[model samples]
Target: MYNLKNKTMKNFMTIALLLVMVNTYAQQVDSIKTTKVETVTDTVNGEITSKKIKTITLKEQAVKTDPADKGKLNADRIFPPTKVKKTVMVDYDADPFYDEKTTLKYFELNNDNYVFRKSNDGFIMNVLNKDEEVLKANARQTKSGPYYVVNSNEFDGIGFFNKEKKFVLEFYNQKTDKLETIEFAEK
Candidate 1:
């Protein structure tokens, strides 16, 4: 029985070797055939005619929404919408406010035009302006974004953030009347 098993194993090995050899030969033949190219040209004679491609340009007149003679045209540009700018009001005239028994109220100024609120911690002088902000040693570091430095005060050219109930920022700029915020990572 061992002799019979050895004979069968040898036959199977021979068949496997034959199959591998057949597959390798098939692949090599295919590779050689793909590299071979066949080109055939047959000529048919006809009368030669000159052909020119001419481009027709259609000039489209801009459709006039408002008639040329209908409305009066102002020479001056319609400003504001066309010209964008940082229109932070220079609130230099805001009066001072102090804490009362519980609520905060403005001091006796020229008019009853000032209003104040109690700070979360202590006194927060909000009526200060751009020039007044420069007085403080802790000036916000604003290198990124559109920043314009006037004297020592830095203003974002685009705009300032708007907060609830006229409160603009961590510290409001009394000079420029814009909200001032400390928004830079310490180096």
Candidate 2:
């Protein structure tokens, strides 16, 4: 019984030693092969031409970087400040929201002589060159479509668009201390 146990232990150690030797040999034999093929096509004067390129790499070597020189930027050596061109920033006012393709809806209030232009979020109102005000409002979606509700320190209103390209606003005016209904038709 003791002889059988000894024989099995020897067999296991021999198999483990053989596996370790095979793994060590595989690590020592380090080589890589890569093949790349590229094709280019060109057409000139209705004539077609094609070119093929093939590249093969037998082995690759890893680049060794110094641990002491880690995180050291070579900015001054690569791009000197004197050789770099100074960027000139022109003082120009450009409106990003004003697109050439966008059609602005302009409306005039008949009773108050106030003109309003429909913007992205709200209405931009001008009272006959006397005053220009921007009223920010949000649209509330309903079954009838989207309706804008404007609530500000000056006035509070609920406005909706009609089929006649008119915006009807029912609002309470704080300055005049009156409830007013105004219609703005697109012009």
Candidate 3:
């Protein structure tokens, strides 16, 4: 009789523990919602107007382990948010021009002006107002397409004439590790 009572007590304890664990897991939330409010004020001709904007966002809570994706590493749970890529914009002090005596062509990119002219053995790029030479490189004509291979110490650029007769220059910037493009519209 004592042995039977002990067995029953063991079964009861095991069942109670399983019920408690199942109840806790069932109460877990799958997603969360957040609300945000923004206020804007506008003034026009001495008149003022005020407005409020309300926004609601829903986000999924990260699951530590997914049953459907068993045995696979969860990259989302292990890795943090991705970092934003940093880009450097070209800056020019002056507007460049194409002079019949020296420059082969003139180009503008991102509102910055530049002149491409022939050097002794390569091409030289200069900013109209700046005293320093921006880039110097030799070009190779590729038979594959209308692209010209241009190289410099800091950048490697590929130039091609587009369908609209516009010259498009793509540069691989070494410092920022980004691709920069400039367009030269034919006049």
lDDT of each: 0.32, 0.53, 0.57
Poorest 10 consecutive residues of model 2 by lDDT? 79-88
Candidate 1 structure quality by residue, lDDT tens digits, 64-96: 223444565633322111111111111112233
Q: Any runs in candidate 3 off by more than 4 Å, and if so which?
A: 1-103, 118-124, 130-137, 175-178
Clash statistics: count for each candidate? 4, 0, 0
Give lDDT: candidate 2, residue 142.
37
Off by over 4 Å in 2: 1-102, 111-115, 130-144, 173-179
Q: lDDT per residue, candidate 3, 9-78, as tens digits?
A: 9999999999999987864535555555555677868988655544444444334554566777653233
After best superposition, candidate 2 residue 88: deviation in angstroms? 27
The best candidate in terms of lDDT: 3
lDDT of residue 82 for candidate 2: 16
Residue 46 accuracy (lDDT) in model 3:
97
lDDT of 1: 0.32
Per-model TM-score, in order, reads 0.17, 0.32, 0.33
Error of 2 at 1 (Å): 99
